[model samples]
Target: MKIELAENYGFCFGVKRAIKIAEDNQNAATYGPLIHNSKEIARLEKDFKVGLTDDYKIFKAGDKAIVRTHGIQKQELQELKDKGVNVVDATCPYVTKPQEIAQEMSEKGYSVVIFGDDEHPEIKGVKSYATHGALVVTSPEELEGVKLHEKIALIAQTTRKVEDYMKVANYLIPRYKEVRVFNTICNATFENQDAVRKLSKKADIMLIIGGKNSSNTKQLFKISQENCQNSYHIEDEKDLDFSWFDNKNLCGISAGASTPDWIIQNVIDNIKSKIS
Candidate 1:
């Protein structure tokens, strides 16, 4: 019986910074959910006076607000500042890079086309920074009705799969005269997927630990499932069904970008407890 683990797994730099910011500013009422993971959010809620607001209007003077790792638009941030809220910006540098790129490209008269989930907060933030019209696309199939402008720029969500972004870029490159593609996918995500793909080859079953709503975590699950049919995505130890591992001895564990190291350690400990 062997338990394999992905070489690069758990919290990425962005998630780490966001969590730390939320934790350190416990004296003030923290505004907005820190991360997508419910478990982590719950832990913060228990420790600090966290404010759950759908809009930034709830923020007041002397209140502490956490700029999530995904980030917010400049205007929204300015509004927060004007309202006299103390903002702890935890935006991931990789995610922030795309916003700056979008701003620069848009200023240069390039119609920006971002390859990412439109509903994602990160994408929304990136789009808001575009001085020119910004379009979001989740797949190459969505390129059918896209109209070309003279100058075009393409960037991807930081957690997006590299192959998916490349495919989208390849599809758009033929139609536009001037197309600039920035492979904005984070290095951590790339390395994590590579590790999962490699681990899948040897493990009998794969256990992915992360929130289901997390984009990067979902990507990891998708990639692992493709390679190993027995792969399972679970948020924590409670979701683990030991029956699945009854006949399996060699299991692999991997987590999403939003998953904290403590959660991953807990899952590992639980699994070991059951096996022992």
Candidate 2:
């Protein structure tokens, strides 16, 4: 059996920065899971005494609070500061860009259209920045029956595929008199997805490592499946099924931005042990 790895996988700049910030500021609690990977979060809790909390009210005066990489709503952040919580913001710069854009464009009288999951923390946070009405859609079909303004501003969750954003942009551009589109998908996401797409075509079996709830990891798995029928999404080494590798000449490994190198190495080692 042969092993292959995606050219760009695991520990994106934002995740790395968030983890380091949390680690350096011991006894601080993050606004949420600092990153999507539970393994890394658990490690931080155990080693650095970093904690996680979604409710800002729990943070008392003088308590250190770290904003997760996905960020929180603008109102929530303001409340944190008003409460006297010592905030160590770790919001990814990429995520911050869309939030700023949403606020700026919406204030300027543009209806905002964001292409991503509405329930995602990033999207929820971004929406808070919009002063005008905002629409979140997974597909262009969602725009049906909705009345959008003649002028529109478009952005996406940092991890969402640009192709989907493009689809939504195509729909609005023709219908609206003026449309401003910002390709807010992070560069790291594009590189990772492209790498997986290329690797899956050549590998017999594909392993996508990351948290089950991780949006970017799920996207990678979906992209891999498009090119390879045998693609599997795994959280860790324990999730690997030896049967999947049987008679496979090449197995490809790709991980989400939040996945740590240790987790990826364990998956690789476990695969080698099973195949040997």
Candidate 3:
């Protein structure tokens, strides 16, 4: 069985940069885990005294706070700064664009509607950008029975699926008076998902490697499962079950934006070795 791998399925630019900064400033206490991957976070925590917390109480004196690539809420940022926290912002530039757009729309007296998971770190951060409070909706159904303003601005989470974003956008366009769409889905996310779609076509079984808690990883797993029923989402080699690979001919491997290449390679190597 020949294994196929996605060209654009691994750690993205945002994740790479964040990890590099964490390593360079090993002593600095990051406000959150630099990225979502537990493996990387574990490694960093071991070497660096990087502390992860949303609470402001832990920060004092010379302690520096590093923001994750997903970004942080405006109020949180301000509060940290006010507390004399030395902040090293690692927010991805692409993720910051939607926040700026939402802020502009809110300042112009338009109602901002963020189309993404509300509880997600990125969405929460984007909400802080709006001068007026922004509304977050995960899907069209969530907006049901709710009255929309005449002038509304729309933005998406950086890791959202493009098709899903369009579905929600089209659903609202007809109901709202004025709607502005800003495609904020990260380019790396789109490319990674696109690569998985391409690989799924040629492979018999698909393996999505990433942290199970990772939203981007879940999205990738869902995308792969849609195209191939034999797809499995696993964090590491230990999560792999031999039964899932029984009689499989070819396996395609892909990963999320936050997943490190070393982890992906380890999973792939383990799976290949199991092939009799």
**Which runs in model 3 stand beyond 4 Å of their true positions?**
none
Q: Compared with the true structure, what per-residue lDDT tens digits does model 2 show for residues 166-261? A: 889998999999999998999999999999999999999999999999999999999999999999999999998898987889999999999999
Models 1 onward score TM values of 0.95, 0.98, 0.95
Largest lDDT belongs to which candidate?
A: 2
Please tell me which model should have the higher lDDT, number 2 or number 3: 2
lDDT by residue (16-66, candidate 1, tens digit) is: 887777788775543455677888887777877554566787888878888
TM-score of candidate 2 versus the correct structure, residues matched by position: 0.98
As a whole number from 0 to 100, the lDDT of residue 184 in candidate 3 is 84
Worst ten-residue run, lDDT, model 2? 267-276
Candidate 3 local Cα displacement, residue 107, angstroms: 0.8
Superposed model 1: Cα runs more than 4 Å off: 29-31, 48-51
Task: Give Cα-based local distance difference scores for all models.
Answer: 0.85, 0.93, 0.85
5-101, model 3: which lDDT tens digit per residue? 9878988898889888887776777666678888988888887766577665687756788989888889888888888888888898888898899
Residue-level lDDT for 115 in candidate 3: 86
